[model samples]
Target: MSTVKQLIPHDQALLVTGSLNAMEDDRGHDDRSLIHPVQIVLDGDVINCSCFDSLGELGVSALVVVQKDPLVTYITTGADLIELSIENDGSAQVRRIEIPALKDVHEMSLLDGVLWLANTGYDEAVAIDLDEKCVVKRIVLGKFRGKIRASLPSFTGNDIQAVDRYHCNQVFQDINGKLCALVHHTSGKQLLKRIARKVIKSQGDGGVVDLDTGQAVSLSLKGPHSVRCVNGDYWVCDSGSRMLNVYDATWRLKNRLPTHGWGRGADFSKHHGLYYVGISAERKRYRDRPDYNDRNLIEVFKTDDGELLGEIPIVDGIEQINNVYLLQRGVVETLLGLKLSSWV
Candidate 1:
C-alpha cells in the first residue's frame, strides 16, 4: 500500500487543490507538471498535466485535492478538462456532471447530508442524495424559476481541465436559513428595476422554504460570496468589490468590513483565534485577464478585531525544490508526494 500522507488539515475535506513539491534536492520522481490532479488516493497516481499559468518543477505539481469528507474527495486535472473523485480506500470514480443549463459548480457545502449550490437559475443548486445516489432536488432560486430553464451565460473561459463552462453556479445559506444567490447586476439600470431585483433575491430571509409548505420567507437583504456560520450568525466574506458585509440570522445587514479584497476561501481556526483568508492579487489588476487566478497568497488575521497578521504565499510550487515522493503500490509515497515531505 502507498504511504498516504496523513497530517491532514482541520478542513481537509474542503481543500480543492494542492501539490507536493521537493523542498530539498532529491529528484527521484519529477515529471508530472501540468495535470491538475485534484484527488490523490495514494500519494501519486499519474500526472499528465497541461498546467498553463506557470511552469518548471511543481512546487506543488502533484495533485489538486478538494475534500469535504474523509471518504469523499474531489480532485481534477489542471487542464485535462475532467475532474476526478477518489475514495479513501484507493477506489476511484470518474464523472463529468453534464447537466443542461449548468454554469460553474463552485465549492459546495454539505448541510444535513444535503449538498447546496448557488447560482442565478432555478433552485440555485443541484442537491445530490449520496446514499440514494440521485438528485433529490434542484433549488430554483430565481423569480423565473419555473420559466428559466438555463442560467444566464457567464463571461469566463473554459480552458481549465474538466470545467465544462456550465457548472459555475453559487449558493449561500444565512444562519437563519436565508439562501442568497448571486446575480449579474448590469450598471445603469432604472431605480424601480433595481428595486425589483432586490425583492426577487430576498426570498429566504427568515429561514429557507417551509419544510412543510415549500414557501420562501423573503428577507430584506442579500448575502455576498463566502459565508461562515458562527453561533447561529453568518460572517460573510464579501470578496467582490472588496467588502465584508455582515448579516444576522434573519439575513439582515448588520455591518461591513472596511478591509476586503477578492477572497477565494476563508477559515477561522479558533485554536489560535486566527482567521486565514486566501486571496488573489490579480483580482485588482488585469481585471480583464480572464483565466480564473491561482497566484494570490493567504491573508492571516485575528478573529476578534480582524487585525492584520501576515500573508502566506500560495505560490504554485511548479518550481519548488524540496517536495519529493514516488508512486508505489497505489500510494503517493511522497517523501510528501503530492505535497507533504519526509521532514514532517
Candidate 2:
C-alpha cells in the first residue's frame, strides 16, 4: 500500500481527482491533447494512480459524485457535460448530454435531483432537470444583470443575456438549503484593472452570491472558488490571496489561514477532522507571484484550525488541478484504464 493510502483511514475506499489541464504542456494554447483529466483509486503514494485517460477535450474543471452503486461523476469539460459511470466489475460507461444552453460550465452540484451549473460564460446559475437533462430554470447572477446582454448561440427566449461580468464559477446548495455561488470577480472592469496593475487585489470582490434571492454578500475575498457550507459554516478558497477564508454560521469571518499556493478546490469529508484542498500550479498568468515556482498539488489540512497536514504533488504526469473530492470505498467505483467507468 502507498503512503497516501496508509495515511488515510482504511475505511476510505477511493480518491477522486480533477485537473484543469491534464498534460504538462502549455494549456492555454493546447486543446487537442486528450489526456485523462480525472483520476480514481489513488493506489500509490507518489501521486501516481490509475485514471480514465480520455474525455474528448481538455479544460476539464469540476467533478461531483451524484450516486454510488454504479459510481457516477458529473464532470464539466468546458461547455460540455459528461456523465461517467463506473460499475462494480470495473467496466465503464460514458454519456454525453447535449445542453445547448450551457456556456462555459464550471463547478456544479446536484441538489434535490437537479443539477445546478455555474454558467460562467453566461453569467448565470442554471438548474437542469436530472431526468430530462433539459434546463428547468436559470437565475441571473445579480451583479451581472444589466451589465451585459446574453449572447450565447444556444440561448433561447427567457434565458438571461450572455455577458460574463462577474465570472461566476461555482454553484452549490448552502447549509441552509439555499442556492449559492462563488463569483470569480464582481465586475469585469475590476478584473481588467487587476490585469492592468491598477489595483492590488481586484478589490477582493469575488465573494459568495445568494442565487435564490439574487442577493450578494461580500466577504472581502479575492479570486475565490470552491465556496462550500460545511457544518453550518462557509469555507471558501480565497485563491488570489492564497488563503482559506472560513466564516461562521452567521456569515462572520472567523478564520483566515494562509495556504502557501494558489488555492482552488476546497472540500471536507464525512470522515471528519480534516479538509482537502487543491493548490494549482503557478502558470503564465501567475508568473508575477512569489509562488509561481510552486508545483501543482493538493494538501490536507486540519478542518478545525486550517493547519497543514500533508500534500500530494502532481509531478509524475499531471499538471494543473481543478478540483479534489473524497470518495468513500464501495460508494463509487472506477475502472483501471478508462474515463468512462461503469455505473456499478
Candidate 3:
C-alpha cells in the first residue's frame, strides 16, 4: 500500500515557480546557465508540480495570471515570452510569442489587456500591446526619471543600453493605472561599479520610480527586486536586505518583515488573509553564509498580525525561485504535461 500525505485543506493556494540554477552565477544575470524551470502549486503544506519543457528554458523569471475565457497565464525566460491557455479540467495549451523588443523580460504586470514587462536588458520597462502583438512604448528608466542616459566613453556601450543598469526588474501599476518601476541603482556609474564586482550591496539606492511623471521614490532599499501595489499599499522585496518592505499609499514606509534566505517574490491571499513569500536559498554569491544548505521555501504569514503561519519547502529538483503567485481556489493550472491530479 502506498502512503498518501495529508495536508490541511485550504481554499486558496500559492503557485511558486522559478528558474532553476539561475542565481548560481553572475548575480543571476546570465540566463544561459538556467534550466529545468518548474512550477509547484501549494495547498497548505502539500503540493503539486510541473516543469517547463513546452514553455522554453533558462528558467521562468516572470509570471502573471489572467482571468478570462480558458484562463490564461503568462510566463517569461527574461528573453522569450509564452502564455498558457488552461481549460476547466486542469489541462493547458502553451503558445510562444516572439517579440524582437522583448529583451530580458523580468517581473511583469498586466493592466487593461496590456502587458508591462521589466526589460532589464534594455534598462527600461516596455508596454506590449497584446492585441497588436508588438511593443507599443518603452519607458526608459533613466529617461523616465528625467535624467540623461550616461555617456561614459570608457564603456563599450552607452549606459542606457547596458544590461542590468538600474537592474530594473519589476514593474507595477497603481490603482489609477499609472506605471511604476523598481530598479537596483539610481546612478549609472555606481551600477557599473557594482556590476564589475558582480556584487549587489545594500546601498539603499534602489527604489520605486514613477514611469509616467518622471518621479523617483527611495525607500532605503537594497537590491530591491519585486514591487507591487496591494490593497492601497506598495509592497517591495528588498532582496539584498532580505526583507519585505511595505509602503502606504502616500509613499511612507509602513511595515518591514525580516525574511529567511533571499526575499524576491510575494503575493497576498485576500480570501485566506495571508501573505506568501518566496525565500530562495543562498547561492554562490553568498557562498560564505552558513544557510547555503537551506532549501528554497515559501513561507506563509497572517496578513492581519504578521504572524508566521507555515512553510512549504521546495526540496529536490528546483534550485532558485523568482516569484510566487496566489491562485484563488479554482483558477486553471498554468502548466501542462504532469500526471499529478489537480486536487493533489
Tell me how far the alpha carbon of residue 12 in candidate 3 is from the true structure, in angstroms, after superposition.
2.7
Estimate TM-scores for all models: 0.51, 0.80, 0.79
* Top-TM-score structure, candidate number: 2
Candidate 2 residue lDDT tens string, 1-344: 12455445555533444444543444544544434565543544433234444443554666678877777767776677878777777777778777776776767888888888888788788887867878888877755454432222222233233333677888877777777777765443342222243323233666666776556666666678888777777888888788888898767999987776778776677456767788876666567865565576667777767777776665534456676777664553343434424322
Cα-lDDT of candidate 1: 0.37
Candidate 1: misplaced stretches above 4 Å? 1-70, 74-101, 119-123, 144-169, 177-223, 252-255, 258-260, 283-295, 317-344
lDDT ranking from best candidate downward: 3, 2, 1
Per-residue lDDT of 43-158 in model 1, one digit per residue for the tens? 21223222221221232221222342322322212111123444555444554433345333344555666654443223355565644545676754433323323222222332
Structure candidate 3, residue pairs in collision: 78-105
TM-score of 2: 0.80
How well does candidate 3 score on lDDT at residue 145? Answer: 39
Question: Among these predicted structures, which one has the highest lDDT?
Answer: 3
Number of residue pairs clashing in candidate 2, backbone atoms closer than 3 angstroms, sequence gap of 3 or more or interchain: 20
| Candidate 1: RMSD to truth | 12.7
Q: Write the per-residue lDDT of candidate 3 for residues 1-344, one digit (tens) a residue.
A: 11111121255556666665643462434543334455555443434344453343555777787665567877787887777667766666667777676676768888778898888887888888876767888877766533623232233333323333566887777656677778776543243324554543325577766777766665657778767667777777887777887788877888888788678788876655667788887776667776553568876666666676777776644567778876655652334333423211
